[model samples]
Target: MGRSPCCEKAHTNKGAWTKEEDQRLVAYINAHGEGCWRSLPKAAGLLRCGKSCRLRWINYLRPDLKRGNFTEEEDALIIHLHALLGNKWSLIAGRLPGRTDNEIKNHWNTHIKRKLLSKGVDPITHRPIDATDCERSEEKKAPRCPDLNLELCMDLPIEMQQEPECSVVPSSTTFLLLDYCRTSLQMN
Candidate 1:
């Protein structure tokens, strides 16, 4: 049999939340601070499941949310992050403060994925559209992507090439490298 429901579905309110529900949730959180989700509905005197309450509080009613359009920089960041992390939306969302995973995932599906496809890119692979996807000749091989088998020989002195003494490794550079390699893959 399928897993049982998380809560009593018949008892709790579902669908869109009302203004009073929002107010009550916010007030309860403000008065008591965040608590265990399972007990939250009962403690807050809400006729909603803890999951529903959590979603409402986090995705919509959170005061710290920077509601509005995602900036151009945000868009690029999301794309780059996706290329590196795939659909690990929570990790991507963590990098972008004020943006939720659900929001980013929806935006990607509805906007960025289509945009990349329009550019002849395979959004998931972040590479050019495969030759097989088109009615192209099998004899003519798909254009190969850039290979990084060769060592990165920066014209820097040996000292500069060495790892820094700092504890924190710079991840941005690594993320960009992955993005570059993935983007260079030929679609056709």
Candidate 2:
């Protein structure tokens, strides 16, 4: 089942918080302590939901919150964390003091992803883009079977296994190469 509601939605304020509301939330947290997010709004005398209060406190009102554009060091650190963590933004944010997961996620989407693409790096794989043009974002992906598990092994006949006396490749090797090219062409 879905989670029980956090609050009576009809009674809670939505959208942006006013400066007075912000002050009240900050004051209340200063007076008390953090956690008990579900009880924060009522205790703070704010007309917002607990989640709304918690997000506002964490994303905006926290005393140590970092503002303005991220520095070059921060940018590189974010990219490295994203490479290791994928879309686990909360985990990535935990390493960055005072930066929210939402902030990191937004920055990645708006800026870092584009930067990686410009440098010929695959943002998803965190590697150089293949020269085959197979991994570019603009290209449509090849169709795949859900249950497919492919394994390729090269096992040549004894006659073909030995290096050819002359420069010409054996028929079996040529045939195998042709099949590979045909399969790849079909996928594209």
Candidate 3:
């Protein structure tokens, strides 16, 4: 069977919450602390849904929230974190104390995107907006083989040999080494 609805939609109030509603919600929360959100609206005597109450408290009325414009430092930190973490707003918000994931997400969409564009940075890829087509294609292409350096130098024991010698092994020699190891393992 399907799950039940969170609340009686017909009976619940919608649209903007009034100052009185905010006050009542705050008062209820302050007195009892934030308990089960599913029961909070009923316990607080609110005509709103639990989700609405939780959002209102978390995004608006929370005491520890940093109200006002984000600082320059915060902007840089958000941009840096966004580049490192991509669209993981909750993880980004964790790095910025007193900022909510919703708030950061909104700020990114409304402000940071424009700011990055103005600075010639692609907000999504975090790459230079003016990058050449060749550069862009390079990102899409498969990785090339890495250069292999197989130089070896060894000193022989006094009774066995003369001076130390250095030799450069070919890249193909790596396959031989692997085959030798496999054969030695099988023998053992």
**Model 3 TM-score relative to the real fold:** 0.69
Instruction: After the best TM-score superposition of candidate 3, give how far the Cα of residue 143 lies from its true spot, in angstroms.
Output: 24
Off by over 4 Å in 1: 1-6, 130-137, 140-188
Clashes of each: 2, 0, 0
Candidate 1 residue-wise lDDT at 38: 73
Choose the strongest candidate by TM-score.
3
Give the candidate order by descending TM-score: 3, 2, 1
Residue-level lDDT tens digits of model 1 in 58-174: 999898888999889999999999989989999999999999999999999999999899999888767678666454433223333355432232344522434312232446775
What is the number of residue pairs that collide in model 2?
0
What are the models' TM-scores?
Answer: 0.66, 0.68, 0.69
Q: What local distance difference test score does each model get?
A: 0.79, 0.79, 0.82
Per-residue alpha-carbon lDDT of candidate 3 for residues 1-188, written as tens digits (9 for 90 to 100): 99778899999999999999999999999999998888999998999999999999999998989998999999999999998888999999999989999999999999999999999988977777766745644543422222223334344552343433444455677677656666766776
Question: Candidate 1 or 3, higher TM-score?
Answer: 3
Which residue pairs in candidate 1 have backbone atoms (N, alpha carbon, C) closer than 3 angstroms, thus clashing?
128-187, 129-187
In angstroms, the error of model 1 at 84 is 0.8
Ordered list by lDDT, greatest first: 3, 1, 2
